[model samples]
Target: MIDPQPDGHLPVAAEKRTADGTAPDLEHGRMINGGENLWMTEIQSVLAQSGTKKTTAYLSHECRMERLPHSETYLGGGREIFQKEKPWEFLTYTQEGRIYQFGNPAVMTVPPSSEGDGTFPPAFEIKGCNSQAHCPDRQIYYFDYDEIHERLLSNQISVRSLFLQVSWSTGGDDWTLYSPCRYVNFSNPAFQTSSYIQPIAGTVLMPVGDSFVPGSIACSLNDKGDHIIEASSRVFRDMAEWRIRQEQPPEVARKSIRDVQQVMPTFFLSQDHIIPINGTVRLYRYL
Candidate 1:
């Protein structure tokens, strides 16, 4: 496990190359080439010195968005279908607090392509466990870059959106917050010529313990012409309530709740779209 220095900075050796002249692998918290390490180094530096909020802000303004081509086809039923001509590209990163698992304060960066210049930015970064209980593993599944890239290229998975989350702690209590989900265009090529109906409304749920708190969901096109789904404020309130019920340490419970007062609902990848709830659920569409 990785350890933080006394001043909270990760070891400078974390960014150094191995003795054999090969760059360190991501599992070791280092990149394969000198160029690829730039963004990861920046993220680590920001987190160690500036904290989570500033690190998140830096990523938000710097990371580049994927731009896939699109096409339109006319169906026999006098309907038109619009879909992406290529698979969506993305990079995944995960960060965990040092307090857990013997100070596992490392960030894992998985890029879409491992070759070339190696300066690509991540699509999103995730922190903490999504489950109601504190997950001891602290490692996200399917975080391998090769596995995600293969799935996307083979059309086995289609990602409609991505979410960013950050976690922080005070004393011994852990806290997490989420940003609004951003809609992305990813379509299955096999279904490109088929016509499908888009639903106008649905229910949104935030997972807490064994149950879920429900809220209203609506979909519309943003100014950029991207199809977006939004959840009502009820979901946020329910999440706050769940955090309170988790019986956090008294020292940071009140502060954690107060800091997350304006927390937004985070969506998860479910089939062709991103859903507000976890578990197996029916897919909803908004046109």
Candidate 2:
């Protein structure tokens, strides 16, 4: 639920912290990357004032509850978060609406020693859902928390029933969109299907793209010889070595399983403001 100041938000930017307990005006302040004085407070204020909300009535008209149709994003990728090292590191790379999250710098370390937190928890989402009969790629969607009242009105089990969708109702000049990831747990008695679990010590361990920066067993370096990127790989190895040392990861968890489904997943239904089959308009459709 981290919000933002009224304007100017994050990802892949400079971060400079100010001293003396003063806050920078994000609306006009300079960008800083991973600094103590990062514009968190200012950003929070913005998110509180401008978060998207979906009312029950809106849900009824849109029929977004119950059945959310599938798209290429989730057509096969069940939950890509676990596969990614830094899923939360996503930033608004361009106005084309392409979201790029940095890949873990270290791809092989089992559980790395986090410079900050451990690893990102877990999350499942439907990457794209089309609501219109004519436009198959018109609707882009993700998941969000629902309120109790809405769940009662919709008559569903589990506390995590709410959702939010993102598509073409947006316009900006290279805006920065920050979406935090969340994981769901339903196997425990104390935990409901909707109950979420947060893992500590979450941090990005892998680097984006294949081919780790060339490095020696004694040391490594990114293509640029920067140590931060190089050191990250070593840090990621901490957990892996321990696992191998202990022979962990449980044998059962090592296998991947797939099941059959009779019905196809669909969307929430309300398709207003959806740009209709505009060949001129190109959607950088995502998965």
Spell out the clash pairs found in candidate 1.
none
| Candidate 2 local lDDT, 128-228, one digit each (tens) | 31111110112232212232222222333222211111112222211111111122221232444333222111111211121111111111112222211
Superposition-based RMSD of candidate 1 using all C-alpha atoms, in angstroms: 25.2
- Each candidate structure's count of clashing pairs: 0, 41
C-alpha-based local distance difference test score of model 1: 0.27
> Where's the lowest-lDDT run of ten residues in candidate 2?
55-64
Model 1 Cα lDDT, one tens digit per residue, 19-88:
3211111122321111211123211101211333222111111223222223121222323233244233
Cand. 1 TM to true fold: 0.18
Best by lDDT: 1
Return the TM-score for each candidate structure.
0.18, 0.17
Error of 1 at 72 (Å): 65
lDDT (CA) for every model shown?
0.27, 0.20
Per-residue error at 48 for model 1, in Å? Answer: 21
